[model samples]
Every structure is written in structure tokens, then in C-alpha cells.
Target chain A: MTGPKPLSNLMEQFQKLPGIGRKTAERLAFHILKADIKDVARFAESLRDVKEKVSLCSVCGSLTELDPCAICSDPERNKGVICVVEEPHDVFAVERIGEFTGVYHVLMGVLSPLDGVGPEELRIGELVARVEKGGVDEVIVATNPNVEGEATGMYIAKILGGKNTLVTRIARGLPMGGDLEYADEVTLSKAIIGRLKM
Target chain B: MPLYESPAVVLRSMKLGDTDKIITFFTLYYGKLKAVAKGTTKPKSRFAGRVEPFVYCNMIAFGKEKADLLRLNSCDIIEPFGLVRGDFEKLKHAFVSAELVDICQKERDTNMEGFELLLAMWRRLSVEGDARKQDLLLRLFELKYMSTIGFHPFLKSCVDCGGDIIGPKAGFNAIKGGVVCHKCITSDPAASRVFVGSVKLMGKSLEMPFEKLDRLKADPGLQGDIDKIVAGFVKYHIRRNMRSERFLAL
Candidate 1:
């Protein structure tokens, strides 16, 4: 009550955003106060726009301004092949590659038992239903290369293993410019295991 | 101490900042400790796979004599136990192991027994990696951990009366530290009556070596009993519920 209510309120609002802890929120609130009225209005408008415009695609669970999302609705995208990824941001990475022509199924999360995330918490049931509808031939699990991500990929593989769907994981190996000498053993091993004929 | 090295298994890790992680480890020599992994969340991090839970890594950390946390300088993988990371069931049991070790281990104690038990479990899991065997291995580990921590249940006789307790007349009193005979049930009002088979199996399970767990003729019914009995004992002794147990509730 003693402090400026609007300034303190702005700090608390910034704290609600991801990665903005108390200290960072304080900095952000001060920065916003120091900025011109026009820039602050644009920032606030963008925040409101995100909440109003973005909704998850019912079929693939990817966040989008439109239902079914842009990728899911594309006729050029291969409907029979689906890339299962952990979050909506992962879709952006795959899109940036511009190599794959398949549609995606965003899992929204990986299986992280330590953090209490399990199969039920993800959008896996929707993925299975999509598979059961019968045309899907392959589900490419593009989960992160970390432990939880690998575990989630394996779990989804098991669920779809016997359902006539070909389950495959995204390859793990050296990056395009990664030095062999500096590479970790696991990555090197995976690179060896996933080697393709030259 | 100065720059030191030890083989460590990451217990669990949580985000420190947008680009860093605070990782807890159960080390080979230093027992349990936590360390900050700067820029670990970055795409080109050198510490990527080595800091994940259940990875046994040779780490060069900035350890101090009185500090609770060591700043991890660099780590090279010793044994990734990659199968455990890739397999769902194996991953679950591995998480349970890490959780138990993190909860049960004390910092700077440097006890080798706990470290050895966990190392053995991860080694076995990496090789065979069967779902059924993973279950057995975890139950065996719970009993082993209890014994190692001196919470080994009193199986041969009643905890209160020193009478030979077996069959339906036996009841486990967690607060009393073991089984109470039918007549001695008044000693601990919180004693939960369990099947004599479960009590006998817990005692028998303690005798079974880690490798021999897979060969044990365990049926679904007995496995269920072992699950219930062991969970009861662990929860009661730890005096708080563990988050990993519910995730592993197959």
C-alpha cells in the first residue's frame, strides 16, 4: 500500500511471464516505465493479442491463431506421416529446416517422471486416436535428445508399436559443424548407430 | 578442496535461469551435492547429455571444503546407461532410484554402500532392461536401501514381545520399527495388518541378491503384495510421500 500501486502491479504482472523471476520482473517493470507511451501501448497490445488469437489446434495440439493450425490444414503436407514433438516451439524448429513435408502432432510435453509429467498429461490420446483413424503409416517422434524426451519417444513407440503404425525416432548424432574430438561419447555412439551409407 | 574429480550420477535437475540448471548429484566419493550448470540449456552446451538424471559421469567440479554446492566445471560421460534413458520402464525405475538416493543420502557423508547399490542397479538395467526385471530390481533395492540405512525390518520375531511372529498373526508397525505379534498389537496402534506371505516375502527378498532377483518365481499376486508392503514401509519411515512412487505405480 505504501509503494506506487501501478508500478508494483506491473512488476507482479511481468513475474507471471516465463523466465521472468522477481528480479528480472523488477527490471522489466522499470524499463517499461521509462519507455515512451507508444512503445508501452504496443507491448501491452501484443500481449493481449497473443491470448486472444492463439488457440491449440484440436487435431494436432499446436497453438495457432486458427483451428487445426496452419501446418495441419495444409493440403501439401503429407497426412499419412506425423512428426510427434514435445512443444509448440519444436514445430518452429522443424519448419525452419524446411526439409520435412509431413504434418505434426505436438505432444505438448515429454515424460518427465521427476517433474510428475506422464503420458496422461500430454496430448498422446489425441495422437493415438489420429493413428487409429487408419491412414497414418508412420509417426516420427521428434522429441528432444535428452533423457525425458527419449523416454517419452520410447513410450509413444510402444503405444503405437503394434497398432500397424511405423514408429521411428529422429536421429541423434553430431551437428553439421560439430568437431568430432569435442563430441560426447553418447552422441558419437548414436551417430555410429544411426549411420547412413555414403 | 581445490579442483577435484569424482564419478557422479545426476539425481535430478531443475532450471536455474533461462539458460542454466541447478543439478543435484549422488557422487562416488562426495556422496550427495548440488551444482550449477551454466548455459546447460543452450543448444551447443558441452554439458548436455552428461548432466541428465542417471548419467554416471567423471566430473571436474570446483569443490570447496565447507560449501554445500560445487560448481561443475566440466563432465565426461563414464557410462550413460543409454538403455535406461531410452526405455520407459527402465527410465521410471531409474527415476525412482535417483529420488530415493537424493532423499536418503546425506551431503559429505561419502558412504560407498549407497553409491555401489545405485551403480549396480543402473548397470543391470542398462544391460538387460526388461520391464519385469526392473520391477523386481527396484523392490530388492528398497529392501537393500532400508537395511543399509539401518531401517531393516524386524522379521524373525515380534518387534515388541520378541516372540516369533509369522502367518496372519503378524502385523507391521512402522513406528515400532518392525512386525508386532497379535498380542503385542497394543504397543503401536498404527500397525497395519499385512498378509503373512507379504512379510515372509519381504524377509525372503532381503536375502535375494541383486542379480538373482530376475530368477525369483514371483507371480502377479506376490508382486502386488511386495509393492504394497514395501511402499508402506518406505513411506512410513521417510515420513513424507515421494513424488516418484506415484509415477512408477504401474
Candidate 2:
């Protein structure tokens, strides 16, 4: 035996995940160690399955167990409109609403020059090729209302310019449950700009 | 070996291989700049708050060519733009503004006006009650940006016949780059139509700054017209439709 339990190694792996701190990692490692063998096996199996089965769709960059993904393969979804999101998580988030009838293109990540992630690092060239070749009518940018995401959206919008495609971005303002009195000036202002007359 | 220092805002930041980070900056002097802050991601690294996104910092950098990615020798945090960090709406609006700077600013081109505009916008939003001014602010940036980049739309004269035009109402031809006289409109097959009233609104928008705009009550129709005109102008010059603008409009 190489000394203490492999808790340190497990914690290190957990820390690699986004938003997981060292303390959380330790807690997770301990939880996993104390869990039933069957549960542990199931967790391990799921992780393996995700890696072994999941691959990017050729049409959109969404992770899928099969090529083209279910959404891209589906005939019912609006082929004319494509909702573009920054990551796969956004794809799931939108899907949860079940409101968007259009298909999607997962950008995988947004443009962040500070991080050295640029146009080249992103799937932008692929998006252009898709736009140029595909029979797309409108492109809805569903990226996070953040700087990198906005930059990415702008870059994509410029690239797909005048190709007969109508490009759009999600409106930002007050949240569903937000109180107007508690809302700050920026939020209230954005809400007013983004308001839809019911 | 000369070291230059300037004020910059972190547009975005990401962790590099092991301990370093890559930060994209909208700088006061250089416009858009990308720098590798070595060991920035580490706990003890000096670049901690200096390179964080949405934070403004005064940085010292060393590089041979202007195009060469600079090495950050030192960074002192200025205004953190802290109001943007946690607040979602503020964060989003600030990001859109920052992204505009990133897109409009040419690398190594010193655009002090654009820099000042960004700083002013940030400062304004950081204060209370600036939200009602959001639309005006964005429009202001678009107008100022277009002016700075030499794409100021022709609002007064007939772009085609060079006729002395009346203001408060006019037509716009994206192809012709200004108010298209009724005679000129009939001549061009692809020109988009605009109203005389709409043209006046556009004229007023183009002439006035954001501060003056906030106090003035805008006719909804006029505001819509101005928005459309500015949108079309931006689309024409940027050579692409802004996807976000459309979605946000929706």
C-alpha cells in the first residue's frame, strides 16, 4: 500500500470540475467512498458511458450518443430556424422550456480573447460553412447575455451577414419572479427596452 | 527595453495550461489586446484581480511589435466595475457594451474617444436609475462608433442627387448611404423606404448625445424609426446582421 487511502487523488479529480472547490471535492470524495458499491459502480458506469457514447453532432456541435443528434435528426423541428447557444448545457436548458420549435447549433464555447479562445478556437468556421451550405432562414443567438457570449454572437452575426438569414439574440430584462421595486436601474432599463406589450 | 502601461478592461479571461491565464482586453491606447498573464490562475499570482473579467486595471506590458502578444509585467486594479459582477442585468448590459468595444476597436489603433465612451457608459450604468437610459446609451454607442469609424450615415442631403434636403423627415438608402429623395428612391430598385418624420427623428438622434437624449421624450414611432435606421446602418457597415439585436428586439 502507498500509505493513506486514495482520498487525495479522488478529491483532486473532483476539484477539476467547474465551481467545485477543494472543500467540496473532499466532501464528494468522502461521499463516494462511503456510498454503496452498486451506487459507486453505477456512477462510474455513467461517466464511462458519457465519454464512450457521446460525440458531437455533425450538423450542430451538441453532444450526442449518435451523430446528427435527436434534434437535428428530427423532421418535426423547424429546419429553417436554428437557435445557436454557447454550450450543450444551454441546449438542455432551452429544451426544458419545450417552446423553441427550431433546431440548434451548440457553439461549444463563447469567444474570450483574454483566455486565448478566439474565432479559431471556436466552431465558427464550421458554423459559417453550415450557414453557407445549409438552407437556413434565421439564426437565433441564445448565448448567455455576457461579454464573451455577446462577442461570439456578434462575430457569428458578421460572418453570416447577407446570406438571406435573419439573425437574432435573446432579450434581457427582469426575471420572471423579480420584483420591480427591488430591480436596479440597469435591469429596469433593460426590462423596458425588452418589454413586450401584452 | 521600454515598458508601457495603460488602462484596460478585461473583456474575458480563461485559464491557460497549468497556472497561467489568457486575458482579452479592451485597452485605452491599444484598443483590443490579448496578453498572457503567467501564473495568474495561481493563488499567489499578482495578476489575480488585475485580469479578472469586467474589472478595469492599469497594466504594464512589454512587447517588441504592437501585434505581438504582450507580457503583463504588472497590473494594478482600478475600478472593478464591481456592480457588474453579481447583478445579472447590469452584467449583461455591461457585457454587451464591452463586446461592442471589442468588435468596433481595431487592434493597435488608439481610439481614445471609443475608450472614453466605454468608461462613461460603465460609470453611468454603475450608478442608480441608469436603466431607463439603456436604449439611448446603446444607440449613442452605435452612433458614436459609426462616426468614429467613418460610417456616419448621411441624414440631411439626398445621397443620390445632392439636393439640399429638409430635415425632420427623409428616406434612407443603405446602398446610397443617406436620405434618398423621393425621386432617387424611385430610381434605385433595392432601396428601403423611410418617412420624412422618421428621417427627422434619425436626424435628431444623430445630432444629439445620450445625456441630452435621456431628458427628451421620444415619440414611440420615431424611436422605432431611429432604431431601425441605426440597425440598418450598423448592418451595412459591419457587413453582417447583429443576431443579438434581432433577438433582443423580439
Task: Residues B1-250, candidate 2: write the lDDT tens digits.
Answer: 5566889877766667777777778788777887889986443455655576777788788877754577778777778665655443455556656656666677777887777767766766666354435655666567766776677778777888988665444567766678887777777765666667767655676676544555544466665766777777777777764433532331
Q: In model 1 chain B, which range of ten residues has the least summed lDDT? A: B210-219
Residue A79 C-alpha lDDT in model 1 = 94
lDDT of 1 at A114: 75
lDDT of 1 by residue, B17-101 (tens): 6778888988888888788888887766787767888888988788677877778899888888877776677888988888887
Q: Per-residue lDDT of A52-143 in model 2, one digit per residue for the tens?
A: 99988998889898898999999999988889998887899899998999998887788654344657667878877878887889999988
Interface RMS deviation of candidate 1: 1.8
lDDT of each: 0.81, 0.71
Give the TM-score of each candidate. 0.88, 0.54
Model 1 residue A108 CA deviation (Å) reads 1.7
What's every prediction's RMSD, in angstroms? 3.1, 14.4
Q: How many pairs of residues collide in each model? A: 0, 14
Kindly report the fnat of each predicted structure, to 2 decimals: 0.65, 0.02
Per-model TM-score (chain A alone): 0.91, 0.86
Worst 10 residues of 1 chain A by lDDT: A110-119
